[model samples]
Target: MNALAPNLIAFGRVLRRAGLPVGPAEALGAAEALGHVPFSDREAFRAALRATMVHRRDHFEVFDAAFDLFWRNPDLPIRPPDPDEQPPDTFPAATRRASEAMLGASQPRSSAGEPERRQDAALTVSDNELLQSLDFEAMSAEQLSEAKREIRRLVLPLSERPTRRFRSDTTGPRIDLRATLRGSMRLGGEIASIARRRQITRPPPLVLLCDVSGSMARYAQILLHFMHAVANDRARVHSFVFGTRLTNITRALRNRDPEVAFQAVSHILPDWSGGTRIGEALDRFNRLWARRVLGQGAVVLLITDGLDRSGAEGLSEAAERLSHSCRRLIWLNPLLRFAGFQPRAAGIRALLPHVHEHRQVHNLNSLRALVATLSADGRSHRRSA
Candidate 1:
């Protein structure tokens, strides 16, 4: 029983490394709770560990896996001591080292006996590829910080789209008569090589309309980080956030540093986590900012949950107009993470038909999907949002 407390503490640390929120306080509480439950009772022990440590629904599996690994070892190296014998400090450095191994943090031990720490190993895995699929909202604080770094590293594969405007090219399909005549004159009036012109290509403009309503609060922060990365990566990215009204934050996101940019955004937005008015917000956008940003074959990304407080009043007409104004309208909803999701909401149904594509935006995996979609050359289909 004397040894149990220290082992439990190390177990809690292992859980923390496994992405659970268990910290020092919870570990102390679990140690105290073990005094009440019978030591011989396995179910009670498991119940006490779970009740004190696990918090969110998404974290339950992670906690369970950690518990199974930490507590259920059949061949634990240290055998129980004789009742007359006692060890100093209950659990020694060895058990904690074993806990680190069970948690997959099996790094080299330092001269002082603790596992050697790396500078930024908050959620370090043997293979870093797994982090790409980890859900952003489920990430712990240290993991979130690491994810912010990864977010900045993300590259946009924005393909250059062709424009109607033409430029002179020798291999072009269309003949440039003026250039042909000029070339002949330069060659002393003799008939010379034909001059040709090809259509000019430019990256299509990206217009982002993000929702900052209460329903979208969990994802809005990370989404803003993503928006900032994309905005700074290229030119012609117009950014706006909507709650009860539309507020353009393109200039705010233009700042290279996220901390500085979000500070400016917080100051600019009067309703950061307010009620949704999708229909009215789109109406406002169409009336004011549509013409300026939606030119030259712009692509629109509408990031929202589509739960309008106004019940989508006049939203269909507004969405139709927006579709016509932009070359492609892609709806990115975090709520689509649910496998059983349906577009039953009046707002979603109204806006669905107008969007060229509807996609999820819950995690890094989903964000990668959006980048992949953009990189593809096929025409985006008109579909449900």
Candidate 2:
């Protein structure tokens, strides 16, 4: 075994704790890769480990921070400093979480071979507050996990629409002649209590069309958790994801457990992280699903960065049709997180005019804004009715 083998193994555990998805095989491979590179060349050693352990682009920042902290003191094992010893603002949220994960994973060992310190430092209340405004794309794995829990608590209330069906109510505007006759029959063939009824009301259906192309992959994963929560929270909620093709994951997301639901979604989606074809995907939905799911005044949520690989071919027509079919068509773009964002993209320009509202959805606060927008829209609708 290489002299550095044990250290490499320990480093993998820290990465996993910090949410990098590193495993024993990756650690062994990294150790072997390190042997070929000169230990004196820090950059080469870091690159070797990174190439072997890091798989996703979003994970790069977390891996780098973990590497720096784990290898800071080579002579000693990885032991993060006390949270009070270092100001939380000094490091980025990702780095702070990485440090916390490291501190929790391995404790300091004494020269006298005393038992290791088992203290764990947790993120403070201020850190949780900061996470609400943090962009989903910039979040580390651990932070994303925390964010998912928060997302599950989000409520999406819809506007109630009256239906043709009626239910009994004492102060109802319309008299129920059939019910009145039945009551009279039971009252010794004499006139009895008059029955009244009112039209039934229910929340409108919600349909989500999310983009899962390479550009939107980071946002898509987190939003899926949000979608799962919404799906389980209400009835008549439909979810679909599109990249090069459109996939209906409504049934998959209906699973009560978010993790299990995501697993089912991953197994079925064929175009995940693939190229985008917004026009084609939208066209398909309008043709195949609009009539079926858009009935009864469903509200449609179109979530995408609007970067169509097809250069907006047929996008305008599809967007117009989709907007006409739904009660309200809301466009949510993560690109809106940028202050200088413009509708310069062909897809963005094609879809903008057809949407009822355009909003940003890159952070927890933005999501809360979405909830508020829907609630306010519901109230306004009630007043208009």
Candidate 3:
């Protein structure tokens, strides 16, 4: 008989409700992955679920919560809680100590005369500890305000990649015959070196389409900090806000300090907490702003909830046109953080077909992932039914 594992499918549902994009495929993946993990330890189980179930940054905390709730051993005898009692952030300190002692009962040493640090470190990731403990969903209004300030300080700065320049050693199919012949004149007509035309690498243009509509208010504020970081550090990054209308605030967010840039953006963006008209916004961007920003390997990041009040056909056409204008068109939608998410929304369905990469942007962890994804050239696999 197969041993009964924790109901991972039910756990996935909990994560989805908590804002993790864990769909049926990911649910199945998590189940299959759990088989490889030793289910004897809570930490091990947590690791397995995180690796298989969570993809985007924003969903990390939701996954953490679901894992914590799912792995609780209800069969263990315990006293009933007081009516006013609340659950602890984690297991009791005494329980944690006992668990640690049990896990650390055995130790291994390396042949190089060093104690192995691998086992303990794997179970306790510092980033996870820092981010997972903070409950973003239940934060008080004041705490949320402070969290936004913290986000501003740690966001990554965007730096330009060095471009290809003419080098003597690099062989190209098109040779400069005239230059090669001219050099050979000094060496008795022996063509040994050649001068070739080459292009200099310039910083790629950045175009950010940030959604500032009603549904995205909380995340939008946080993401503006990220945008400010990128805009201040990079010379060619353009920023635009969309709600009922599109407003280009690239100039406003170009201030040296992220705080100042965000302040300026706040002043200029009058449509905060308004309705989302993604199609109309994209239409404006394509018709008027595309040629201006879509130059020199530009990458466009479309940040929104994919909740369009506008019609689907308009969004599809506009998204398609926007995709064609950029080197890479990445859709950074916060809604993707939910588990069991599907492209069922009219807006989501229409826009997905045009995006080169549809990634999640919900928290600091996810933002860090975006940095890695952006710096590297590997393509993200898009799933389609």
Candidate 4:
């Protein structure tokens, strides 16, 4: 038996506790692989252990975390974090707690104000990265709660559009003759620098049409929270929920408290978690609220699973009209999360041709990607498609 066999076994057990499936057989294999590699080469040792132990790509991060936790600086005593420092934001409750415990264990109370500190940047960094990559459907209750917190902090920075209004600017292309003369009055009516005016720019209005039907319940529920967060964070975010009927929840989501806002939404929307009527819902929107909210170059986010109870009747015409009304029509479908997903449904097929962009929105990562897509252009405005 190798002298380090016991240590390798212990490490494998630690990995199992950390959510990786490392058994005794895998531990034995890892120990054997390590024996062939130079023990002095840390990278070689890690690679050998990883190849034998980790079965999935997602397992790599957990294994790396475990390896770092167990093998880190044997000579140096662990130092606990200072009492004043706030705990870092991390995800997947288990990993977060473990990191905080480890960091806190590294130090003991000291009489001096200055406590020795060593930054565990990698652990904190990897924890967040891992959390983002995790599927929302696979998250535990605790992880889901954590993910919600991250979503609350999320921002939707949409591209700005030029307004008919103008603001006085020193570097503007158009000279303001009236303001220039007014400024010159201070210097004996001689124009020192030309006063200029530029067209005012503001973010395009964001209109979200979310599906809250039976097939889209989970994703739609999370997205409601997301929309509420965005609505409260910024102006011009119009939110609506649709099932068999269209219900505008823009005013409902305006409250400072999310729970209160959600309750308000529930009171207003009666057909949630029911059958979907995407075409009829879009038809209602076009007839009643389209001109009201879709003005000022709005970007429409049509969120749904595209499962229509009406078999997509008038879906194409309604979809095309909605697409034409909005600056950019993005269809965010949770169904797109599947690898082999196809637009086989009548509603999906009917709506696909009209949308400017079709993307997934099943998790925080996808939501973040939505923000990225909207904010891709640094310019204030891009011509609407």
Candidate 5:
């Protein structure tokens, strides 16, 4: 066995503890890479670590945290310097001050006795990326709370472009030629009255169906904020949460502030994190709210992993009904981020046939993709089903 294999195993175990799924194969790969790395140079070591460790976006987060904690050096008491030992170099005063600012600590007074002012470049360079090693499922209560904040900041705002339609008024370029000809008969060829067209602008309605089952609890809080933004701004937005039951929380999310809206939703939703019944929930939505909310050009976002505990019959019935009513039915499954994912489950197979678009919603990058999907022209939208 190689000497570095043990150290690599230790690192992999640390990552596993930090909520990553690093296995023995990944550890062995890291160990093998160590043989090619020039550990004498700090930059070379860092480069090798980066190249050998991260396999996926999610892995990057855990690897970063383990690297920081594993490499951090605690201050030691002053002693007589050994000839063979290399002394730690003094970090620049500016760098030290910047580090203090990044930690939200008070900076020490300068040599002139005045407090050091923060510079934008200094602050930007000093800021260490926090979410790089954070696993959403493994974060502590405080870390989770901070993660939520970061998620909110990273969420790309959806662009609401007014879709053009054939309108009869006084300004539109798409001429109502049939109407114009009908009016021409009244003037007996002596006068021609041009029919005018005017465009009516209305923001597209956003209909979000969130899965609030036990499996989805990890993502519910953060995704609720994105739903809130859509609900509050768009006049015809509808929001619903489903587990064993379907609960409409459009009014709750319409509150001006997201915190207040989430609180209201929590009060209203009885099954926030319970057993999943995708079919029954869909059935209720189809029977009760379909016609009311699915009119005009409404886009439906179905947020779930298609894990139907209520059987495929119910899920299919509901999904088929919902798909027919809406202009587009987009299925957002976080499980697509996995390398070897397939719609092999009965629930997923049933639900997949009804969804117009199958999209991922696992991380920041995925969330940004969702914003792009929403803003994209409906005409250009692809249908997988």
Candidate 6:
């Protein structure tokens, strides 16, 4: 057991570098687990280490690749393969990343180290491109952390809506009678110059209604990071999470730090990762919050998978009311990521017609597309008016 300790510790470091959450504690746990299993049996050895080191479903692939490369060639150093040596698409993203980490550990230092570093940097850029399209449900702990950082930089630029109030403008289309008269009075009633004004325009309020049911657990967590960023970036942003019941989390998410805001949310939320009751939750929001937050032509973002537990009862009416109350009601469903997805579920059929736009919220690319859609919608509204 003492002889294998150094090898196990090095393997743990490779897993960590490959973006698994393995640490010294997990390494110790693996060592203890291996004691019970026969070391000579390769399959048993792999199983024991896996049980101790891997916790997340998404980490399994990377862990397996790292384990194979490290244990099979214990003494041999593996250098990164040249990009042209093999087609990049032949390897899975997890395998590719694991190979890179293992190579970084064993590659010998050379005088021409600058080129090697540049190649590693290029590989990193490639990894980020792949990450943008990766599903939130498939991301490992490290990837999810990186995704959160990317989410923070996302800007939700809503369309500017005209208000009844006016502001002074030099090239105004409409003359300001009140301001013109006031200015003439200052010139001894000579009517010297006409004052001008233009209608004031500002971004509309944003409302987020997220589902935190059992099936949507992973997506809800990632979307909350996005909601936190949006809430802090602008005013009049309201956020709510619902499962068996609705909870207003607008105030909780307003905290500057994302970690603190999520902690506050968890403390207040009682029905997270529970059963879904879309109809009842929407009804509650309509009665308790619609009048308060759905003012000033607000844009509503409803994030859910549309798997209702209550058989869609009263959901259509509630959705219709919500759509009418806001300037635009956008339904963001993760299920839409499937190419063959249909509104076969009762909840989806009930709510589909009520929404102005139905979009996917499963990946970072989808979220970026959403921002583009909103900006385009705002511009169209301005042109049409």
Among these predictions, the greatest lDDT belongs to 6
lDDT of 2 by residue, 117-210 (tens): 8855575457788899998867765788899899999999987888889999999999999999989998887876889999999988899999
**Ranking 2 against 5 by lDDT, winner:** 2
Quantify all predictions' global Cα lDDT against the true fold. 0.78, 0.84, 0.68, 0.78, 0.66, 0.85
lDDT (Cα, tens digit) per residue for candidate 5, span 1-385:
3655666665565555443446777676766776787777766765577566654332343455456544453122123234367432243222222222223212234598678798568555321254434334434434444555555565333344456655787777667777888888888854377886666656557789999887787676567766876665557788899988999998887788665566567667777667898988889999999888887677889999888776666788788888888778989887887778977888998888788899877655576677776776654354552
Better of 5 and 6 by lDDT: 6
lDDT of 6 by residue, 47-102 (tens): 99999987644356678888888898868877666779986546665677677778
Q: Across residues 1-385, which tens digit of lDDT does each residue of candidate 3 receive? A: 0444446655665555443456788777877877887878778878878887776333344456445544574233233244467553344322322222222322244489677576567666674456633444334333444556666555443345446654343455456666788889999998777756444456578889999887887677567767887876667788999999899998888777654565567667778878899999999999999999897678888999899876554999998898888777888887777787788889999998888888877766677677777777544455442
Q: Which stretches of candidate 5 lie over 4 Å from their true place?
A: 1-135, 138-170, 174-195, 380-385
Candidates sorted on TM-score, descending: 2, 6, 1, 4, 5, 3
TM-score: the better of candidates 1 and 3: 1
Worst 10 residues of 1 by lDDT: 88-97
Give me the overall lDDT of model 3.
0.68
* C-alpha TM-scores of all predictions: 0.67, 0.73, 0.58, 0.63, 0.59, 0.69
Candidate 4 C-alpha lDDT tens digits along 139-174: 543465678789899887877788998999888989
Better model by lDDT, 3 or 6?
Answer: 6
Q: What is the C-alpha RMSD of each candidate to the true structure, in Å?
A: 13.2, 7.4, 18.0, 17.9, 17.3, 8.1
Candidate 6 deviates by what RMSD? Answer: 8.1
- Look at candidate 2 and give me any clashing residue pairs: none
lDDT of 5: 0.66
Best TM-score among the predictions, by candidate number: 2
What would the TM-score be for candidate 6 when compared with the true structure? Answer: 0.69
Runs of candidate 6 exceeding 4 Å displacement: 1-125, 378-385
**Residue 38 CA error for candidate 1 (Å)?**
49
